[model samples]
Target chain A: MADEDATDEPQGPRTTTAEIVPLRLPPVADEEPEPLEDPRTGDVDEWGRSERVRALVRKAYDPMYRNWFRAEWDGLDKIPTEGGALLVANHAGAIPSDAPTIMHGVETELERPVYGLADHFFKSAPVVGTLWSRTGGVVAHPDNAYRLLHDQNQLVLVFPEGSKGPGKTYNERYRLRRFGRGGFVEIAMRAGVPIIPIAVVGAEESMPILFKVPSVARALGAPYFPVTANMALGPLGALIHFPAKFKLRVLDPVTFPDVEPDQPRYSRSRIMDESEAIRQQIQEALFDMLRQRRSVWFG
Target chain B: MGRRVLVTGLSTFWGGRVAQALEADPDVDVIIGLDTREPTVKLERTEYVRSDENYSILSRIVKATGVDTIAHTFLVVDSTTMSSRAMHEINVIGTMNLFAAASAAGSTVRKVVVKSAALVYGSSPKDPYWFRETDRRVAPARTRVERSLLEVESYVRDFARDNPHVVLSLLRFCNVVGPDITTPLTRALRLPLVPKVAGYDPRFQLVHEDDVVAALLFAIDREVPGIYNVAGDGQIPWSEVMTIAGKRGIPMPPFGIGLATDPLQRLGLVDFAPEVIDLLKYGRGIDNRAFKDAGFAYEHTSAGAVEAFVQAMRLRDTVGSDEVDYRYEEDVETFFRHSPAVVRDTPPS
Candidate 1:
């Protein structure tokens, strides 16, 4: 009786019965006989940049960038709308959450992908290692930076302070560390790209470290192990953080023409001069933002 | 009277194909295929000579034919498949004999072309991204095949000095893959599962068997003055290669691999040597720009070569181990017979 009723009810085309269509991926390039070029496809680029993993990470961190922090980015226009560029900034906090934010900020605004170069230690960590590479974080080295800026025409972000800035305690917050030996200037000069200084405020308050345990740091093979106020409260302490509003200010970009840094005319003083100029610009931006802010917690 | 050419080791696959390639060419020439054993493939229009390179045998052939070009394709890297004595005689002594004959014949032998392996670079953590011909050929002292090839290269280099009239050329091939290839590497990749170093993902450069023949033919037609490292440029990490080969890669620690593969090796299930394990960790890469500058183009990259091998594997339920059986430490029958009796009703005879 049920079969006869079903047959009697369905007099129309069988298309209506299709609740879910079988997913079909179109054959790669029509199955034609054209040869395949060595293309950077799927998840990763030739330099190990992964779009899929970057997208997944962006989705996971959207809440932090959008709601809890309420981050506001200013001077987006200072970043070139096209071509290669470098965004040099001061890094802070145990976890460099600002790195990803700055990266996503510029990339999303320009509708282009940006690369972040971090310390080699990050690549040795378990889960963060994979996440770092997939989200376009390269192991910080001259060759890696050269390849990104020059060969790939990428917007690479570098923290000249190395690991010192991010591991700073709350007492030393907002104090700029020494930029290492003007490497970024040489890179920008060679790549023929401009360097845009970025000043990120309230990043130091994200994960305030009261003290560090050397023994724990040694055991975990980490550079420094921080005992934050929240971490001191115990395991559940990490579940919540004191929300600090983030204000990002981009300084004017400075550029040097594409020239070899080794020439006798392009002495070490000239490169250092370029580096110091950019450093001063970032320091001014930080002080300006600090003065304008009424409260650190409210931005 | 014409530009006579003689190809040694006609019994081998590379030798057979090279001879066939020369036989079809319209360039004024005569083709002579010389070997002791019968060829593995049919040699059309190639005059086969059944003789060893012993004493006066090869010298007489070189003299009587007045063969100006000699293509030596007998270099072997996988030594596990053959008897130790046979391998040394063919790879070491046979080369000495051929060079002696050519050296004695002097200017009559116009050219000596060797098909060599790029294993001379040796897999190392310190190796460059791509090895140029000018880079040092630094193989470990214990690596016998590579050490022996170095010996042959020295001889070839000396022969070039002694017999300067002969245009000597060397082609060092990277890993080779194709449908007709039956080497230890290809056979290992054909396995259902392969082991990789847990954290080490080394890049691989595989030249197709056809590209190897094509380069050999170019050496035959023109006099390439120096050594050339021949490999397709489609370099990628082994993990990606495993993805392409459709094989499940089990990541094992470098030392832990011994515990897993030792029993398999002892049982003759897996033929990967210790050096091969290192290859999986720090694979080899060779620069083929010199060949490109010489007006030769490769039709298959490393990826294309691997894809062809995978396609051939899909066509057959399983790849046969007939020609590749010699690549192990023990005989097939001995391996099956020693297999704990419970697993074997009848050992393969």
Candidate 2:
């Protein structure tokens, strides 16, 4: 089995020869082929969002969007029809109808897809996750946000308060939660996209959380188990909304001109300041919209 | 003098394919393949050396052969093929010994290309839509395969750090599917009823087997160092994959799925490895742009790979596997490679 002689005898003088053979060759410039056709059987995209599903959802949800919520948008023109922008909204209600209302309104009005960046908690559930993904719900990861905002150049709607905004009691309605350590600001800064603050009214009254049972939430492994005023109707109330009017106002786009995009890290104080400023702008807008409101159901 | 390369796992599908590919490369003069078993594929000039599962004799072989490039393809990513103990031996221990041999004092090896799987990134609901090369797993590995692969990667990282002069490229390939390769996913897809977790349709990123070999060769040909994700362009949902295969899916219960699959596994109905189950739940997507930026072109997308596999399946169903079963005969191979009476094509250098 001493076969080294057979292999090595042909190639003589291994030492000087080793020096001539380069360890790393110059990379061969492969002729780039025309992109192959993706043989996909479904419309689900790389982000799991499906346009066909989104369109179908819009068709079915249009009635509820127009009638039940009566979702109305102000300063919708302020949102750029093209290019990427982070749509920051104040979340409310036990189920938080604002995300869908805002997404449905922007998508229908702008005639563009709007990806709702939600908690990964939605992704953990089986049917809900699949439905959420098909209807344009993306997990609110910084990378996911950056890719959507910068790479794909799509509109992304995120509630800065996360589950905290909706998980609060009915008395805490319209009060904005802390904006999640300003991660959204950092992501927008990294993506170099402007943050468009959207203030919403009547989401608080739609499915108001009377109180939350932490024990039940813990048992169910949920963020919060809410006892909503809508639940007084029946078990179906969990899915039903109280027919509260939804009025949404898209605030001016906030651009971080001073900071460079794609930075490894941003100034902590700068992120906090920018995050607080955006929160305050949305809070004030909500109060302004609420002051002009006649009735929760009527808006 | 041309390149002398050492390929691990000569009998395994990847190792045999890689060795065969290297044999076709005129630049690579000497090809030595190491595995516990004999080479499974036909080769002309490559030399196969039998070694134990842990490759304890790798250092001696490395020194004797003076191989400059080592293509480590032996790491077992499929846990169903062996026991956890054997997998640990092959993946973790074998990798440790191989790296040890390569990075030894006065070692001739300068470049190392590791064929790693994207399973190192454990699939979880919290995972980003796309995992960059630098992204860590959202959760720790739960299965033996993932854990073992992770361990092998750590050794690769350490070897790279210790031997900075050695150009090391770690190619993390996503779920590979094509006409030839038989992975857990492919096996499941080939079943009469493709098993899926109930109410969960996760998107999967797939690469064709040809692209996988091409990526490995590309890494060897170029000086592209660092971790590069080797996958096709886009992701396809599991349901769409079954649809492309022209097969219906049978949903496995979402809860206690491991317990549910045990009986089927014993009955040879389905081979749902624990890692694959997690993959079927919250599928993985790796960022393949880094490899593309490194100038490797992929021939198939996620869906295209499935299409290729399905097309092959259709043909196989009609013709019943046209592959000629070639067995390795040591005496015949030795005579062809070493016998003095045999006429040489290249005139002995």
Candidate 3:
């Protein structure tokens, strides 16, 4: 029996070749054209269930935590119902409470399980880390991202401006930062999905940072502490939070073509082009909205 | 095989000067000059191609000439001199035509050198310290001619990249002066009386025509391609130019016109052509570190150019000739009318 096992293992050593010959694979036939939907999408009503969770969460928290803050939404209905989607929003708050609001809005309003990025929050904390990893709260890795979208039919949200938006304090609020060359466009194209640009007004003002307490933030591994409203002086730090009326404005979803039938799924150029188009549309919309917005201060 | 070199707009005053410089270089085997009118400066080897508009001639001339290096020196301070369509057609489309021609011809061309102006820096009290190749143009330019230079510069750079071998060199010059320059500054410096003191005393830098000639020639000789500030070393107050003219036996400009008339003209109290207005208000200057680094040696100064022009005017008996034809006023009129928007607020990418 041992001799038979040895015979099955092959008795010769592998030989190395001096001349490298390029090998080509035989083409495979196209069988399944579309990707399989996640079981989550099947059992949970993606459009309705996600929003229900958001409403429940927001209702539970807002009165106690955000009495002064309001969520303003634009073009909320244009979110695509079936396929994978991309949501790009401006990042503002230091801790980036805006991401949570955005996630909540999409899940509650659009009714989809929204996966987004968290800087340090998900990276630490063992249980929350496991939850994030399972639920597809990507730590901003664009590659693992492809896998998440392909495997999960999930709505991926990105703050393309990254640190630029969130790091801006109250003194410099609402000023749009430079958009990085459109990578989100490429992702949508790869996933054969559409992009929904969500612009949130009043987020910048809510956490109005009077000045950056850089030493405190850096020591704590955070970007900066924005001294907002009553948070400047002693004792009243927790109670000084101001109620700034907030509005989250979502623009129309921008769609891109799927990877070409015979072409590779990941085409960088196609992705960049799609991203640029979406970015331009969002920028124009935001600029126009800002111009027409009646409420400057959330009052 | 010998290479073909195209020089467009070789009929204008500075263009004629450049054509003469190109004639001196033996490496330039075949020459093609594209101009609306036949070139007044005749070259034995140059093939003169006449088109009513620059756009019509660009592609065909490039194809026929098989030009590998296109040296552009087209100047039209006013777009209205040409039809509005013609202004864009000549300046923007004409450049695109060249780019298209280069792309279409698929020649072994290695470089394209375009002469742009430093005026695109706009009026600055010197926060830029010196306008580097990347310094943003701050002020909004008044005329279309000022604005088109930026557009043309960008388009040319993009075009050059389309053909990797076709690299671009943008030479931003600050008032090129040579023996041949009949510009109002040269002419004004040569005038007797009132010219003794240059009005406003703005720090000015001028590139000698010889230096400009050498720079253009170097663009062909060397393969180095990038934007550069081209000017002489001496930053002279306009007064120095008048001083040099004075020593050369030219009469100083009438002092009255600068103090009274210049201010009145600028203030709209007195009537003056746009050219005269431009001349009176020409403040701000460029930093020439890049030109110096590029190994350009200026053989003349703004003062020297003034001396040369004064000498020429004297030789032609045009200085103090009693009849100030004021054809420059017409030139200014034509420039405003024909030139496209000159300065763009956005910095070049």
Candidate 4:
């Protein structure tokens, strides 16, 4: 409306569409000005998840996931392409390589990162904790998970069976342990995210535990010192894997009622039932996969 | 109404600077500085009072000056000049005397801000990477000074609870580095051979002297209850700190440090406090979200803090000549140009 004051204009309202041009600027001193610090630095966030570190970790372990474990998977589409979700899987083996395998498979398949919530033990162990955090591992806590899911909208990977699954004896392999009074279910319910049950088959067999030494475990401040038949061979010999092919089955996502983190609509007993039902699904899937599999060394 | 502020420990740089800065503020009605020794720095409005560890004298000063705010920075960090026994008495007992005086002052002394170190958290294998205020502090009797500071904090806490009307804030600061603030870490990392723990390279989240003063001034202005961690952002490894200070690290074994620390302190080469070993082995830091929530922004980052100390060392190297000091300015610029979390501060042309 103020353009009428501009006498230089040819006309008030008559004009052809003006051609849009890309922004052009005069050449300046130091074009492409470098950042003050290295771009590779400060990649880690407050939660200690570093995309750069995660990328590097994935690069180092991709071969192991593919060739070493022969990890194969299905139903990644069950996870929402957007928004947060919980990937509740079974934990197994003395050294839990299952976290990495499941994380790698889901990350590569979904083309999105899934943060693994590690125990406080991993958060306290000097170099290990720092490295763990950099590699997209958050210290497992209700507040952390709540923030990751509700506030940050991140897909999180959790092993509800916890240390109980891995600390099991050789005979207890593939049997899903109690899911720690069902905290993961409550987390899922509170965060308002669907729970995708993940059943990993090859982990328990990959590093099979022949037996364990509880006294040694207690001395080392570990849950149990698993003395596998392969481990008895020696340090480097223990590293030699049996090449048990990992077949991952991701069941359909189970939705829960939306609630605030501190809201008490969901009781302890109901959450436990839901957790048990989810655990049963993964356990049954493991049995079915075992029925289909012809050999332990091969898929 | 204007703020009547009293600054304790005028002998210390932190106390003197805070006194002077508060004196400069037009909103401040009066500034009263108290210390055992005379202040090295000149002040404008602050009245310097030479006072001993007498509760009655401190209480009289508070009431006479009508001081509502007390900034306590006299927590003896460097005790090379004084005997260890004297330093303990001055730090612990003096603090108790001040608290007693302030308690006697009652609502007249509305606020008391105490300067505590991050060392209260202690360096341990079990410590969280970023310590929160709720995390358990170190048990008593870790080091002589640390134990004293711990006791002092408990006393302050008790005082705060007892006096509901009074506002008490405890600042847990990490290692502070700048031209003015001279700590043992800065002296060790000065030049040539930087003494360090053999196998450990702890990460230090250093705060700039400017940031420390700013935080103090901010607390003086606001009423933020409870304890808050104060430090500039980002952490630099101790090895990197030595490297940035232009020194080659001399890794000392634990036993060697234990043996030589006494002689080193005696020679005044460095203030080798007892807690230095644990600090060198395992670092201490805290998550400073509380400060952020209180609406304060830091001017310098951790990298800048270390860089400022290094620049000061360079300045000290060429103390007599302004031309030589100017030559060292570019080195600081170049050093900060590549440092993470450093802000580029260009002078107004």
**Per-model root-mean-square deviation over C-alphas:** 16.9, 4.4, 25.4, 13.2
Q: Write the per-residue lDDT of candidate 4 for residues A206-299, one digit (tens) a residue.
A: 7778888889978867767887756766887566655778888899898875455557557878898899999899999999999998877688
**A1-299, model 2: which lDDT tens digit per residue?**
45643443322222222222232222334665588878777889988999999999899989999988888889999999999999999998888888888888988999999999999989889999999998999999999999999999999999989999999998888899999999999999999999999999988999989888999999878899999999889989887999988888989999989889999999999999999999999999988998999998998
Highest DockQ against the true fold, candidate: 2
Q: Rank the candidates by TM-score, best first.
A: 2, 4, 1, 3
- Cα error, residue A71 of model 4, in Å, equals 0.8
lDDT of each: 0.72, 0.88, 0.57, 0.73
Query: What docking class should model 1 receive?
Result: incorrect
Estimate, for each residue in B1-349, the C-alpha lDDT of model 4 and write its tens digit.
4567888887687997787677556556678878877777755446667788433388788767667788998887654546768877777888888888888833378788998888778775445556777777533456777776778888888999998777788898888898766787777776468877775556567888877887887677667768999987766666667767777888777445767777877887666777777677556657776786766566567777788777887887888334321111334543565667676554222
Error of 1 at B95 (Å): 10
- Candidate achieving the largest TM-score: 2
Give the better candidate number (2 or 4) by TM-score.
2
Pairs with steric clashes in candidate 4: none
**What's model 2's TM-score?**
0.95
Clashing pairs in 2: none
Worst 10 residues of 4 chain B by lDDT: B321-330
TM-score of 4: 0.77
Interface RMSD for all numbered candidates? 23.7, 7.9, 33.9, 17.4
Q: TM-score for all predictions?
A: 0.65, 0.95, 0.44, 0.77
What are the DockQ scores of the candidates, in order? 0.03, 0.39, 0.01, 0.05
Give the per-residue lDDT of model 2 (tens digit) for B123-230: 999999899999999998889899999999999999999988888999999998988898999998898999888989998999999888878877776678899999
Sort all candidates by DockQ, best to worst. 2, 4, 1, 3
